[model samples]
Target: MDSYEKLSYVSITPHAEFLRNFVANTICHSCKTSQRKRCINMADDHNLCSECYKTAVFSIERLPYIVHNLRKFYRQFNLKVDKNIPIFLTDKVEMRKEFDDKTTHSMTVYAKKSTTLVIKNCLWQGEKMEAVKEPKKLSKISILLRFGYPDVITGARLAHEMMNVWLGNKGCMDIQQNIKEGICKVMAYKWLDWYFCNYVDSSSDNGRLGLRYIQIYKPEIESNRAFRGAKMAVDKYGLKHTLKHIVNTRNLPDVNQATALVKIMNEPNEINTVLLAQEEMVEQRTSRKMGLIFS
Candidate 1:
């Protein structure tokens, strides 16, 4: 499967087992010490102590607020899409099968026509009554996330999936998979950074835990080649310019080209000269190719 199909995270299994065997001799993935009395093994193959487990599970009720915050955060970058996109939480078994058990955290699926039930309100004798459902076909984009994770992880995953939605809305869905995933990862990383800096308070225990996880995960994201390249582009050229180039050309600009463009912009007098020279070279190449074909 293409890497873009799903977002994967570093599994705590190996680290947990290593700590259990050598370091702290504890089965718990979090709080590696053996002091906790009870440890529960989760379906995803990580053992969390009672106290840690309580905070590890995310609540579905908070999903709407996360989505709302993401939409608000995206506005600063001028990324906008439908206010409502169906997001569902699924079991580890289903997610594992879909991602071939690569430790996937989330996936976004696009459909041309999806069957959905629409309710029609019915009234009898001017009183509110039952509602009837009818199957309706609609184009939609849906996000499926694994059932359990901390709030920070869920927010980051949703932010990544929402970037896919934005791409589809901007008609840039056909771009190369690496570029697409790279941009999405960048957005997710940005969201994490924003969350840590603005929302999280390091004074509290829960806030500190969230910040720690964000620190661990952000580095993993930076390790991916696509993500690294995109981040470099964004850092050097700015997000607005980099995104605009991607949308216009359907490709990431090479370092040399980006540098030259920046130089051309910085030096106003050289803009026409640089552009005309580049255009002339292209014309000459085209003429030469045509002559060779005719000959």
Candidate 2:
């Protein structure tokens, strides 16, 4: 897959087996049962026994609330758009066929130009005339999210795609693929962390389930070496500074350069000492490893 595509994987497990194993060790928040015939874990701090789970699943709809919350969460980033982008809950088959067999969770489509009629001026013989046959080039953005994912998973996918939208809107689409996708991954991971901290009740059963999901998802997002490196940059510098650097330079900040700058700044009078010390540390470590190999 192209690094720029920004794909996420989904894990599908049988509902029956999932429930059986889930309730085996964890207490159901709804029925307060550690041992139940069947139980299902849910997002938002609610684990339910078989009957309660069925009732909750059948009667309660959480997608709208999730979407609303996500929209609200996105606004906090301050990535403004001239208009609202449309989001559609779609099936996997409707998504790109290349990812059909790959268990793709969601995708954002950005079109450089959408079809629209525009007036064109022309001179017929001697007089000027207007023609309407030509089409104007206008950019379009839309999100296609596969239905049936758990609420939290759906939220994460939406968060990822929304970052894509933000990048496109900001005209950062021309940047290097690894760097662009790495930024998207960073945003998605940040959203997941924010969601867990602000929304999930860490003390509740649902909160525990949410944390487990975050643990599983975060590593997958960070699996890319570029993504990991980008995250390190964000950690060392602030997000605002990191983002500004990416936008201004169209590249990730050089780690070696940043480290040297930090050293120089911290010990301005001992710049040479710092450099020599760093070089000596590297040589000493290499010498110890070589000695171990020879011995």
TM-score of each: 0.66, 0.56
What's model 2's lDDT at 180? 75
What's the TM for model 1?
Answer: 0.66
Give the Cα error of residue 268 in candidate 1, in Å. 12
The alpha-carbon root-mean-square deviation between model 2 and the true structure, to one decimal in Å, is 17.9
lDDT agreement with native, every candidate: 0.63, 0.56
Best by TM-score: 1
Candidate 1 wrongly placed segments (more than 4 Å): 1-38, 50-52, 57-59, 112-139, 259-295
Candidate 1 lDDT over residue span 1-295, tens digit each: 5322243333455334323433223455544544544554454455555445445433345577888888876876666868777776654555564457566778876874655433222111111112233344444676777644566777888898888888888889899999998989988888887676557666677776766667677887989999988887876665665777788889877766677558644564554455435434544654564355348
Clashing pairs in 1: none
For model 2, the stretches where C-alpha displacement exceeds 4 angstroms are 1-64, 81-83, 98-103, 112-139, 258-295
